[model samples]
Target chain A: MKLLSNSKIWAVAVIMLSGLVYIGSCTRDNDLIVPVKLTQPFAPNRGTNIHLPGTMTVGDPTQWKMDKAHSSVLWSSNYIGTAGLLTGRFNQFGMHDVAAAEMLNYVATGQPLLDNSWAFNEANPAQTFFSGYVQINQSNTGEPGRDGGCNISGMGTTPIVAGTQNLTVTNLAKIKSTKVEFDASSNGYIVTFDLTWQGKLAAPLTKSIVGKLNYITMTTIATATPYKVFGLQLKFQFNCRDFGITSTSIADKIDIECNMNFNNK
Target chain B: MPDSFFAYAEWVELETFFAGYLLVYAIIYLVALNRPATGFVKTRLLPNLPLAYAFAGTLYLGLQLKNAYPDYTIEHLTAGVQLPYLRIWGLISILFWIPLLQKKPVFSLLHSLVFFFLLMKSLFLQLFTSSPGNDMARNNMKIYSISIFLNLGALILVTIISLLIARFNTQKRSTGI
Candidate 1:
């Protein structure tokens, strides 16, 4: 009782509380790691040049439709704290899907080429050789605050940055060898495309991806009705910083996987 | 799980909560630090800026720990920081950081009780996690239990002595000539 009433005890107690607050300030990071990991070379600065296998071939020119099948993008960033990780995906990515019914025989069997005929259309006169866009508003990380920040705070309001700057159709009449390359190997196709986020016409990034022909059909049974699925699967990892998105709390690496499931009909 | 909305929602909550807490700190600075309305911005609050940041950061870390592992207790050792939760240490930091009450001398029992309450909560949790599967968790549990016991013993001893003294007084009153 005497000790409890002692002024020294209270003084000690106050000091203890203050001590806790001090320790809280110092803890900035946790080195804890999840067992699952995605291994990529550490290039902290900006440019990452990845090269894949195969030879380039030239093929026929045509237009490809960009619609929403299951063509969504998934991204994970570093959490605010040093130890945590955050993951999220876009619900609506308007570009990247093509109807399954459309013949993908060109990609499956035809010779791989320096094809820039992705956006060529007979209906439109101002059509370019290859073009598509990603809507910026479609960026949703699940958390409202995070989604809001990604849209407004870090990167300014630019819906889509042209991956290739040479969009002038007249200039793109002749498909340039240096601009794009598609090499077919025994396993799949090695597509070396010029992928830029904010600027620069030529940023060659090679990815060994399975040909769209490999996964031909997907079935969806809706109790009474069944539907088949088909489309291209595009996967790539790029640092958000390259796209002018400045964020200290998030990991620079953003992995985008578009499993485009075109409509069966 | 890489793309699940709920997968990383906890981190978003952590960021939002900490940022929100900054506003409260600002209010405290205004109310306590800005006494006697100075012509120029008060310099007294300047020194406390770092301390305020420290309090908010650490508290948010604690909250982060809580969110990540709802099993958060005094015995919980943080994996990344490798720091065992010594909760009293946290309380001490908080109390010392309060510059406004730094000079004030107040109740000792109340402070002791507050610490005791913290210890009690941890002890309850320790009873369930006395033996954890992971070595880190087990070691942390042991440390947490020891700290609680030490504090409880001191607190009880004082109460016991006070009770014994009261009993002795009653006996004297009844048997006195």
Candidate 2:
């Protein structure tokens, strides 16, 4: 009774609560997903020097620069045993000017090559190559708590800090095209790229991802600048197990869709 | 188990747990109001349960917020520069715990002022800082409004109960009962 006086109740509560907090803090954090090696670096400010296919013949070649605001990289996966899918977007990502790289390859080898393959349909307007990275920390699903959990499970883990930009270089899902061919059977292009991500083990995991470039069009954004936009849509899927994400709620296969708009302002 | 309890439905689950906990606390406090402090367990241990629960909940919320936003700070919180998810509920959890530590009626009434400020903060941020398109903001407005009011009610109820306890003790002393 003496020790447990009314005034001493707060002290007792403090000690007990501190114990619970200490136990919780003792749990280990998940490993962080880091990129192995990137062949090309992301240059957000640089503009593409290569002309739009077929536009070179029309004498008004459009040099494209990525319009960051109009572009989005979205991901979705079906819930286990459910009809609905969980959708999210990578808030921060940038595209590599694959066209410029292609032009450089043509200059160097006197052969138009893409991802070490011959660009047979380089003149096709629908033909385009993609190279980019999605920042792991910027994965936003609108819900912050879910975003934290998803990031931990899907992209390994990242420490939550005060700033918006965190581990910008290390925590990334990088991709570069390995092969690109215009499909004569359909009004689209088939793109195969190398996806490098953090694996379940210590070493990084690199896998080939095949996707379809189903939509490519030239449009104008009716803004003050009246920007000429070259829009590209790419869709692909990869198994989450490849990255060691074992969350039961998330389906094994994740569908990724990117709507990127490049502008010539 | 902790993850399931706190991270079940994200925002919804957290708010539900808090509201439910407060309701339970109010009921238990009311039931135990007139009971004689027969022993150390009843007088000392039982009274501290609210503080223990408050600390546990606050720690959990802090960890949850930290996991969600790593770089969050008191400055960022006050600036309203970041998402409202960390701002409204995190502060509420923190402020609610402070009054639970004090036993005096006057000290507990101080929470009324804290709640008032928090209420203003919620209304200002929800109406002004959060963008209209933000779903979290819309949900926050609804959750914060109800929870803050409930907290105020609980504060008032606790104060009244404290006064009753004082009067009860005075009557017993005077009558030598």
Candidate 3:
């Protein structure tokens, strides 16, 4: 009881000390909790009619362009046990809104088209498209030290010079996808890209790592903006070997998510 | 991670969690040392210390929950902040746990603090932070947060119970009951 037998005097003193430590915090509305999904795989629903775009309906695929300022690409990966979650993003890449006639029609009609597919202009359903190339070196993992680590060791020269990190990674600089297509199995769009990882980096002991960056992201919205627009999300998974990363400390697999916003270009 | 790197470095985050847990107790024990070692010190104060730490741990965990996200940890806030001590904190805390062997009220207070510290600043921070990233996760986090607070409040009540028991013993011994 004597711990507080000095209660009155200690109360004043303890309060003073508490004040020095706590100093108090002000409640503000500044923090934004960005959402992300890990280990998410994409598989569109099936049994529905598949619409493969024709050159005429889709327009000049080679003529498409992405407005850099309007879109963003964020990626996330994991550590082995609990280095916590690791995330990085491309500061520069190519991505733009889907300008498909069906999607635009949906925006105009305020309704999605039938057969579980986007209701495009019936005459040219494949006329809608969204595509671009994602640069490698442009990936800023948020941390300079981490970015440096990835560039110097993890990614090797691909982000810098493709052949330097993994001689086999001939397309070292980017992961390019042509168009986003609706998949019946997963009820999502399937866009594919190839990542040339360091399958085998030059070494003293010969590390056996075969690397390749590959993914199919299911896009979503964080919040909605007018024109049926807002930020887009792409979530998927990959193996560490894809980047020629082979170590027990390095996890076997990692989940990735990308967030982007696009406007009509 | 590669064969050349120590895998332990990735998971055992001493800088944030382990060291943070140890510091919660060290701070309380050091504070108690400055005061007179009354009978209440062993019974009431010691247990109370850990409880206080619990409060600290929770707040810290809640605030630093952002670090669980790689984007947040690497987001250039403490540009030069690197604590080698965190790596060694686990080893140091082994010694720190020695003081906890004796103090009950102090232990409760200190133990709670460690719990809170680990949750907010250590591995638990990531679990708790990421738990709320989605609608389902957010719902689960609500239950989790409620339980954490409830447990903390329970510890506070236990400290009070210890205080009453210590007072009853003091009264009995004084009157030769």
What are the root-mean-square deviations of the candidates from the true structure over C-alphas? 27.4, 27.9, 26.5
Question: Model 2: runs farther than 4 Å from truth?
Answer: A1-62, A97-128, A160-164, A167-170, A220-226, B1-177
lDDT of 1 by residue, B1-177 (tens): 012454324323322222222222233334443365562223334234334433533554576566568676645534433222333333343463465643331222233343344433433343334323233323333433343343333324434554577689999889993
* Order by lDDT, highest first: 2, 3, 1
For model 3 the local lDDT of residue A226 reads 21
Predicted chain B of candidate 1, TM-score versus the true chain B:
0.26
Report model 2's TM-score to 2 decimal places. Answer: 0.39
TM-score, one value per model: 0.28, 0.39, 0.29
Tell me the lDDT of model 1 at A135. 34
| Total clashing pairs in model 1 | 23
lDDT of 2 at B110: 32
Give the poorly placed runs of model 3, Cα more than 4 Å off. A1-65, A81-83, A95-132, A158-187, A190-232, A247-250, B1-177
What range of 10 consecutive residues in model 2 chain B has the weakest lDDT sum?
Answer: B104-113
**Model 2 DockQ class:** incorrect
